[model samples]
Target: MERDSQLELYQAVAVRLKEAHARVRSLQVPEGVRMALSRKLLAITAVAKHDLARAARRLDRLMKDLDEGRFPEGD
Candidate 1:
């Protein structure tokens, strides 16, 4: 509920996402399926990475605003 807690939650999620992304990148598919499915898998991972990045940026902005004493309009 508070800004500090919210910021910590966002940072924890971002860290987990990054770890998952790295694990996915390091996965090795069987040679037979790798040729057929690699591209699609890579695309999916790319989208996940992009979404995670966007979320991190938004969280960073929110934290900055909180630090500057600029509370959201409604709260």
Candidate 2:
């Protein structure tokens, strides 16, 4: 991607990540589930530091799972 387009994608991913984190925080799920989801989100955030595109895709999958009411299994 061009520099300008990559910057836009990164910004959009950052915004989506913020929204996802907030949504996870607002969920009424059990603490274990919440922590599991939070860990997944944090992992994606770390991935974003090295691979923005992969992170975006991972975020999309996570948000989709959440939207479909698929909370992570407890540890």
| Error of model 2, residue 29, in angstroms | 0.1
The Cα local distance difference test for each model comes to 0.49, 0.95
Write model 1 residue lDDT over 1-75, tens digit each, in one string.
677876775567557545534543454544443333334334434544556555555545544543465543221
Candidate 2's TM-score: 0.95
- Top candidate on TM-score is 2
Clash pairs, candidate 2, are none
Candidate 2, residues 1-75, lDDT tens digits: the string is 599988998999999999999999999999999999999999999999999999999999999999999999977
Clashing pairs in 1: none
Model 1: runs farther than 4 Å from truth? 30-75
Candidate 2: segments with Cα more than 4 A from true spot: none
